[model samples]
Target: MAKKLSIIVVLLALMGATAAAQDAKAVLQAAAKGMGTEALKCITYSGTGGYVGIVGQGYSPGDDWPKVELASFSRTINFDARTMREEQVRRQGNYPSRGGGGIPIQGEQRLINLISGNYAWNLQGTNVNPQPAAAATRQLEIWLDPHGFLKGAMAAKDLVGFERYEGGPSREGGFGEKRNILAYTMGKFRIQGSINNQNEVVRVQTFVPTPLLGDTVEEKTYGGYKQFGGVKFPTNFHHHTNWDHEERPQGYFGVRDGGHNSFGITIANVQPNMCGEAVTVPAAVQNTAVPPVRVESQKLADGVFYLTGGSHHSVAVEFSDFVTVVEAPLDEARSLAVIGEVKKLIPNKRIKYVVNTHHHFDHSGGLRTYVHEGAIPVAHRDLVPYYYYAVMDLAPRTLEPDRLSLYPPDEFQETFVLEGVQNDKYTISDGTRIMDLHLVEGNPHAVGMLMVHLPKEKLLIEADLFNPPAASAPLPTTASAANTSLYNNVQRLKLNVAQIVPIHGRVFPWADFVKIAGSGKTN
Candidate 1:
């Protein structure tokens, strides 16, 4: 009887899969025909709209990714070559230099991001920087497009379809039209998209792993379709990332305001097969391979080590019983490398705490790895909403299933492990080694920025405040807000600092910082 039951289940699943495939093909065919993308091989779209927001550069935790004026934006997607090139000309306009990532552009900044097959690179003037890390997501952007979604789904595996009601019911809660949902597994990414009653591919989304949100939500919505040649193109395009990092109110997908509203554009022109000649993979980028995670340790003081290798750095402070790591930057591989280095530096001691400098994604990305190792994250109280509840199993992390999610420690009770720093000052001491966490006052870069100070060592561990340029590199022309803020805060806190161990650059004496940061405030 048991054998018969198992056989019945297998047959039922097979039948269901066949039915799903049949339904998926019919739905996709209709959407392709309705959108007039049945014969499209490539496309070029251009427009002017500033609403391109940089993730992790928002004014506050809940604020939308900071926006800037894109004087012009254009993208070319080649289905045949499986390549994408996006060009944007951004200007400072009204945006200020508050957050990181060169926010306040004095003049026009031209950017060209190119991805072909397995390689990704960026072009700025005559420079070519290999961005191998960005290849996966950049490639995904191609399929996120409306017509590309159909083409990708047609070749995808395990394709299925279902009817999705926007609200409670087909007509309940002011819902407009019925949507046909199609899902498939393409490569390592599982894509799910919806077609509206008008047969337009209105939404395409997938789960991407993120340091802050774990299984972060990445979605693209399109509307305002207009005919360009035989193909119908969307005049309006909007992108949302980390959409579910916080709870969102129930509603059909619409233009709403939140940190997740990453980028938007109003298309004015669309040309088919105008993607131009195939983008040649530059030799420089082609020769570059994904670099391995390397942690080069420089002893800052007794039991204090500066972990630097790549663009970012972390400091591992050793204590009698355990260790504390400051500024876990980048992602899993980086944090893992730093952790291994910490173990080698201070063997047989547990990593007790990870001091987060700020809530920026780049700085806080590796906190989860430390949390997985049973280290409590210490951040500004304002970030409790962003980090405290974020580590929990709020959403399914099936996309990548971080080690923490897959195998938490036996003592882990699934409780929030974040330790919030309050009242501008949080101290960690064993009556011998003292580390002071002071809130950076009047800095527009981040609201809850904290700079770690070891009084006895006269060492200040800071990030974003001042990333000292290489000794060989030329000095900067303009003084930055972050540098000025650091100069003021060092004085405001009245802490003596001899050597500044920066999380971004090599260790430099405070005198060098004085030259770059200078004195006084910015208007």
Candidate 2:
């Protein structure tokens, strides 16, 4: 699943109380006054826009933040309000670009552009009724309230009160919709909006539900604006969700906001007319990718041959003449290829165990494939049950999933094998090399993450943390805190880590980790 941007940026601006006195019609009329009919009817203002939100199972306080940073996306939208003909192009970046392919928003629903006019999909979070449905789904049906906030808001009015805030032409976007707070009896889960003089909604702020945090007034904000051709929309918005690291009373909040969910543009340089075009895979492209090349596989003690996979952070252990692959990095495609390579080396050995480092979607993307291939996943106790019941339960197998969908055998215990080994630990052994799995204590990267240790190889298999660069590339300015904690765990465990195999980066000396952590050295 794609990661949901954080909620910090949503609740940036708060609408004071008292919007309860006004009705929806009054609010729409006043907003239309600011955004003249011309601008509202055929809105066309373009700059750069983005959006952000939170993803993964319900966030746990103190869990590690997302490893791969949230996607920074950009896009533009064009909507001929009169014809309701929308055209859009979405790009992924802080600043919008033209080279990327556009996901068609108009004319089809499945092709909904997150950044363009269809951002209404974000409203899915609002528990809105069935979204406008259709055939192939190349477009989405957005229910616009006759007044302009969101059609669902009308029903929301019964549950919450409405209040209009006093503000002039705003800079968040051009002068559009402003004022009106739909306050709820629960807490500050209000609707803050702005509309142009033409009465078209230029923006709407659906604050995140409060009172969920219990005594914590954590607020989330939403924004929308009308871009090209009078499509009233929420261009700039954010949310303020509670962060895990800080103490309960004295809490620190993380801003989960700012990444465009959809885009539609009319500009020539940016958008190209839609025609059947396949993305060209450039020939003779600069091959910067470091293909995994096996360095050395030494037999340490009986039957325990530590088989290190090529350059990437993958390792294989030979136990009782059978093989157990730990860490399937990249994706299903990569994992599948890796599986072939492993079999080539160890002929006809069924992959008995596929140990997962963590569940960040990427590292474990090929999990289902492993399960289908009959590899019992050695995972954290808390994660196994969720995977079986939730992640592995249903298959929306549109595009091919990384792994085949094979439910465990008939007598299969619903919950797979996931138990703490020692110190919240677990291990897998084939009467050969004992592969120990231990959860990194106090790491924020993931709640129940495992760090693999091969006592015989004296090699540690980890994901995300301390991925040593091939030729000493500059260290990323902001190293993940979760990875840092993994290092701390290594010290706590006092295990001899001769080589550190990172799931993503090239394997490097464990000493490289010491250099970076202790002296802040990258090279």
Candidate 3:
């Protein structure tokens, strides 16, 4: 009788533990549902706020880029889960209204409204009325509940319970693929929550993750809630992605203009069909440069030389004590070639500052090599912390983790000055000669773009806005709006530009830009 009783007690204890584990599993499932299941269904909200983006800087050791900041942006979204229809509208500082004068009619159309739906076309660019991918919505489901059971992957399961008794500390999270010298660390944090009888999660006390600027991280927090719709939503979203995490589908490069980069959806409305259609391939763009290229250098001004051929254009400047290269084109191999050429031109002079034009992946991707070479990157002011904390520090460190690994950690032995002035006019001068860094104002290229101004040569070093027409090509018969915008900027800044040297074109006189803008003519 005594042995039997002992056995029964042991069995009861095991049963209790099993029950607790099952409850935890249910709570986790609810959490996952909150992320995708519920959030995806909720719609029709308007929000007005500001956002920031971090770009370029560098990927190697000790290199950093600048951040782009924007204020006064608003959005409105409308969603119908039962019919799976969404609509969105967006308005920016002084930009004209988008989306057929307000709310779109017919079919599901909103931002991030991922229902297995097809694309529906409408007014203004591409209007996707019904997203075709919606057919697979049920199959492509994602779980967001923190404690929810994942469909597969034991690693994910383990992560959910890494600190069941008490919340674990927050570490840097990976965004996309990790790369060399890109800082990627989050602030330390912990969480506490309770599960209801129905396996629903409620009252989650989230310790905020800190956003690092250059080398500093700011701590933040969020408190989630269980709403009546059988879903949990982070009633408060507090953590900021290195880039602005707004659901809107448009991006502005420089200044506000009447042109709208509407990918078809707004805040309160979502056009999931428009999601995939947002990226359009510029049809007219054709690369005619030679292959397995070689480099050709030309002296544009005193201390400033334009290195062309070998696939890309790079401007090399002889600074007071070192040589500064404006842009590092292409990947490590290309950067290595650039380094070799710069060394040959000015023997023993170190390549100092690599001033990136913007943060697009293509333009600033090669920054890792500079970081490894111990060169500091001078970028826009807003991107400092993101470079130091989110990109370089915590990024993946193997398999071509970039040249910066040649050095040690915290050995960022350089200065990355990100400018903050939003004026149309700015200059970096060495007293005798002044180099103006003009914001492209209303450009759709990249935000906070810097155009190098050479006053003595009356030259402008720019990228993406306009390229030189081929030597054999005839002058343009029709004007391009982009060309007109570039001209407007020149007039706005009052830049006495004579020569226009694009990063991807043969040399051309500013008169050419004027002709293209003034009368749809190109030479």
Candidate 4:
């Protein structure tokens, strides 16, 4: 009798497993039918929305991400072909410029971005340039779309699985509703979608690689579903970064600005199966490889060198025994190139210190690379904790391993913060060569920003404060408050300035700055 009962229990367990599998499949099918995913081979959507240049804007340590205005935007995607074309007309508002110079206020700026299969390129008016990394990212976004995700899962049913998920509390309040989740793996990315009671995909979550963060989380939400021409799509779309990394290491999450990197779009209309044009790669772009690192060093003084190869620039000052480099801009590739140039320019002298201007991603992204080279980073005292906890301490080089990740932690030294308490001034000198790092007071661009001053050379090097207008460009009718503040600081300090070496634009005389900033005198 006992053996018979055991056999009955085993049969019941098998039945439960079978039922779970069936439930998963049913949920996916329901979602497909509700969203009209089966008929969604291609789609073209046009909408007007704004986008913030989050990476380009500087944040004050733990402050929320800054905003940049995007006047008009539109996108078209072909799911079957795995292609996308995005167009935007950007504008500059009251927001302060961070690094890549201030946007032109005279006219609207147009940009066109395209991704077809494995190819990605950008077109600005008449210029076309290849962007391989951006193309890869765009491809992932296409597959992760609500309708696209459903169709892809059906095709790869062998690798798809579903489970009941308790999504915790709803945004309104109380215990949130339960959801059926469809999860799958595509290449290096892991994707999951949550289906609600209406059999519609409410949200999709995935992971993407980043230079600062190892594997960053990206979440997209869909709502206001409407059927257009026999295809159902979400009218309201919102996407966020670091959405699921709340409890993870600070480095893994990157930004804690309450989804400041997030953006939304309200769809005006959708055309189904309309996209079919084949994207042709330009000859110039197809033949163009990753440009070799080339640093054109201009000797500013006896021991000072200005390193310029790309749009961004860096300064290397040779000390009595070691060297101090200012502003490690861009990513690891750019930083590695700059470092190589520094080594060649000043042989045998180790890069002992790297002075960071602010916490903007573009300016500070290469700090890790500098740290890997055994250089101490000096920045605002408040930023040290964020950099240490959110950047250095949580080091897992799994995604794109750098020199610091490959080596033991013991090999690198600690970062240095310029304590603003005992005067907002930090200096590095060897009696003969002196460099004063002072906080740019009252500047609207960034917090705890440091301007490098060579008293001996009467030269001041700064970033984003005042990028001189091009020789052919006309002077603006009004000056930015940030530029005005920079002029005031220079006069307040009473430092004899001869030349102003801006990180973004060409070096200009100090007189040019005063002329543009209105005499550095109060109105």
lDDT of all predictions: 0.83, 0.45, 0.46, 0.74
Backbone clash total for model 2 is: 90
The reply for model 4, stretches above 4 Å from the true place, is 1-26, 49-53, 69-71, 92-107, 155-158, 164-173, 244-259, 276-278, 411-422, 469-478, 519-523
Q: lDDT per residue, candidate 3, 1-523, as tens digits?
A: 9999999999999998677556545555554464443344332222233222222222211222222222222221112221222223322333321111111122322242323222222223453333232323211121112221122211232222312222233224433311111011112222334433333333233222111112122212223443533433333323222222222123322221111111211122222112222222122211211235467789887777888875467888876678777777666666777778888988888876777766554566566677667676666554343344333443334323455544544635344333443564555555666666767666545455667777787888887566778889975665444466678888887879888888877888888667678784532
TM value for model 3 = 0.46
- Clash count, one per candidate: 1, 90, 71, 0
Error of 2 at 443 (Å): 2.2
Candidate 2, poorest ten consecutive residues by summed lDDT: 97-106
Q: Using TM-score as the measure, what is the rank order of every candidate, best first?
A: 1, 4, 2, 3
lDDT for 406 (candidate 3): 41
Q: Which lDDT tens digits does candidate 1 get at residues 173-287? A: 4655579999987777889998988888888999787766577778998989989998888899888887643454333123222568777889999998787768999999999
The superposed Cα distance between candidate 2 and the true structure at residue 36, in angstroms, equals 13
TM, every model: 0.91, 0.50, 0.46, 0.85
Q: Per-residue CA lDDT of candidate 4, range 255-369, in tens? A: 3333235556777788888774666678766666667767788999998998887777899999999999999887788899899988888899999899988777678878888
What are the per-residue Cα lDDT tens digits for candidate 2 across 133-183?
111121212212223233334334443435444344565766633455443
Worst ten in a row by lDDT for model 3? 177-186
User: Looking at model 4, which ten-residue stretch has the lowest summed lDDT?
Assistant: 413-422
